[model samples]
Target: MSQMTLEKRFGQSTVFVASTLMENGGVPESATPESLLKEAIHVISCGYEDKTDWGNEIGWIYGSVTEDILTGFKMHARGWRSIYCMPKRPAFKGSAPINLSDRLNQVLRWALGSVEILLSRHCPIWYGYSGRLKWLERFAYINTTIYPITAIPLLAYCTLPAVCLLTGKFIIPQISNIASIWFISLFLSIFATGILEMRWSGVGIDEWWRNEQFWVIGGVSAHLFAVFQGLLKVLAGIDTNFTVTSKASDEDGDFTELYMFKWTTLLIPPTTLLIINLVGVVAGISYAINSGYQSWGPLFGKLFFAFWVIIHLYPFLKGLMGRQNRTPTIVVVWAVLLASIFSLLWVRVDPFTTKVTGPDVTQCGINC
Candidate 1:
């Protein structure tokens, strides 16, 4: 292919270029323009035959969108190893997406890449079994790929409270004392894990909470979409375009990027989630009041779940609002439109209404 390309472009001159470079010792400083071009072509063609790996594996691997990770994993699978170095001062610095849209798109790209790997032949779950890759390292890679799948359960969990509020019923079965003890133990373990992570990593409490908040926001939005997008590519052979993340502009005023808004479909899920949870809280509380419930247990339980969803998506809500003191008029209108439509649907459906059965149909009025 390289020879064909060179012939097509340079035709008979390719021979002269190679001959010149041979005499020039392949050094650009000592070589003519034609010789320099030949030197580049030699490296591109792997003519020197570097003994590190095969020609294809000379640089980054290319199957997945995240070629860097794929390359590293392949190296490790082949018995190669890497070291960790943490300098007291920073070794390098990089820019980040300062705005919500860019950040979400960046996350979407990464999640999509992970999904690509998860569904591919090189998926760490079942791949590299015959290789030198250790079990723990393989497990870490598996975790990286499968993390996006968590969005499925997360979305269900987030929407559960809303569904329960709207339908006036809980789908979860009543648990016995043993189940309650198990639940308490699980909660305590999770709490202990978080505390240990904070202490060991030197991460502040607020930072840990922020990480949790962003995890939900991305899980429901970007990761959820990535799973579907990846399925489309893998199952249906439809391709997704890779988009480069936009970086913060130095020309902008301080933190201006944070207030900048760009429309993306990724925003819709989280926005809807925020609205639904808020509605659930309001409707559940209103129902509790109207029914004059002697026990506040169920109401509080539903409210806790609803509020949990809302709190997780609060950052997303703020991003939609942008720099305005109030939410933008467009967002307000959109929210109101959704609320109105859902309200009409709820009235029509009335899922929780009890059926009285009335009189027998055989002895009914003239209409029957």
Candidate 2:
């Protein structure tokens, strides 16, 4: 029954996209339930395998698994964040979702899983001071720290930049402000992804890890992997083939009409970002003498950029070279995609071409 609801939502999105394709030819955002789940999950999990504690939800896992089995914190922080980006917002929003519903459900679920950890058996830890006295406290502290990552400059990003430049303010140097925000966003996003991957992998990405005897049986991010696979199944059923997002595995630029530009850029390879990364290893040695500043940073930056660019490149090239075998590959696919994009293209299509959308294209615009 639960799965059916999920499927229905997924199907709803597919129908919406397919209808859009049939109607407008194809707008990029088909927002079916599967893709929504994947996006939400990815945004939440990313490189999740690298965090500690899993935050506060450990207690909710309750007596199901002893303390010895658990590592770090209890809550699946990334998973929690990922939940926010789901198809429909939760009924009561963040407060109710986390504090009440998630808490009760996860605790019961964990208990029901009947999984145990070696750590639970060895230590008086789960029942001791750390277990009862400070579960939420630990999570609160971690959550508080992450707040600065997003909270500090949000007002500035949304409004202050224009205001500051107009007022000629220099208190928080514009360059410093932008750099800080961008770096913080990138670093935190990556860290969040890594941590989510680790903590929720068992439940979200792959279920094999849940066997408790699997190679990664103690996997923290098992939740996300399992969930992601389920979402993938949802996506597969949705007929989102015309939707171009990112490459599944091998990193490369590809037709990324599906997702937003910011994410696609992250997938783009640094080498292609500029020749600097591609040739920097050798170039830095030579340039270091002339520039005085360490060429290493520039070189590294380029290489890093290339890595991102390469991932995006596959799709970009595939689409550009006309080599893309977007299955059901009759000319109809391209025609539909172009038409869909036109219906939805509010801005320039970029390096692809100037397939612009007009105010006239907006169906819901006030012009009506």
Candidate 3:
């Protein structure tokens, strides 16, 4: 088939992407339809050979710092604190689509690399993708699902006053600080991730912004939703979902150091989200107290400081009173996910001096 026709076929839908990845044998054991689609776009890209590896670029050291060197160094100094955060993608274990099962490794490597550019830190292949496009993809991921979900918790915050007014549950009354803390956390995540993405992609914000938010929203939300699903499974003691790229969904049943590495890799998402939120909580509470009890933002303060009180303490007790099972881990992971999202808000890079990272922005013989 012509390259143009092949591209069209691959772009058909999530199912098509799934089928292609599965057919290529690159399908991850835990990959989701959304991740599969993304992999297809990159691997079979009819254009964009000009992409560069993002990790090699630095903010602006006059060709001094690489994207990976600068951002990773800074974030590492930050202890990669975002690693402690939560609501990461659960492990997906669905069946791989039939037919295409040949190009599995290439597709798996590509998908895995994409995850690294956006989330993974240990993967050396991540920096291979062009700085420009890699970051554009990451930002698209951030502004879409990660940020909006942070806003959902705001609904809880917005309703706090109403909850107090309506239920009279508090002799002291309270507002919801949950949302604000979450919002701040999400903001931080955005800032950190964005900075890195920019340095990696090497494309100016002007060029990135030229792309619409809707597509960003669609790509990002779809990606995270899948991840969020996988995260839920992690807490359930299930196998990690490798659904994003399907090189060969064949369960080798062969556990190796890589499995440990895969697991160790997970530390990045959870750890990043956890620490950032904790910091935000400290920051929020201090900020709230400084403003006095008069500020409704304190409600978020309380929620952040004492979600055990706000959610588990109250709800767990209520569940006990009603003889219900209150799975706190669910709530815990969700909270961490919220914090994970919060980190997205802070995503940013120092700017890379390299020309292109790779597939998305590689300059190897392609246009610079």
Kindly list the per-residue Cα lDDT of model 2 for residues 1-368, writing each as its tens digit.
Answer: 35344333323233333443353343345466776676556434534222322222322344323232233333332122112234455555322222211222243233212222212331223333433335564444334222222312332232222222122222243367779989899999986775686676434434432332221111212222223333343445421121221222334334233222221211112112222222323433455556666645544443343344333333333333343443233334443454334323422322223456655637767765
- So what's the TM-score on candidate 1? 0.78
> Relative to the unseen true structure, what is the C-alpha lDDT of residue 284 in candidate 2, on a scale of 0 to 100?
38
| Total clashes in model 2, counting residue pairs 3 or more apart in sequence or in different chains | 88
Error of 3 at 278 (Å): 2.3
Regions of model 3 farther than 4 Å from truth: 1-263, 298-368
Q: Which ten contiguous residues of candidate 1 have the minimum total lDDT?
A: 46-55
Q: After superposition, how far is residue 347 of candidate 2 from its true place, in Å?
A: 29
Q: How does each model score on TM-score?
A: 0.78, 0.19, 0.20
TM-score of 2: 0.19
lDDT of 3 by residue, 235-349 (tens): 4544333444332345643322122212122222223333343444454556556768775543553444334223322321232233334223444466457555544433332
Q: Report every candidate's CA lDDT.
A: 0.77, 0.33, 0.38
Model 1 residue-pair collision total: 0
* Candidate 2 residue-wise lDDT at 272: 25
Runs in model 2 deviating more than 4 A are 1-182, 203-276, 291-368
lDDT of 1 by residue, 44-126 (tens): 66344343333345366887877777888888897766777678898898789988878989999889999999999999988
Native-referenced Cα lDDT, model 3? 0.38
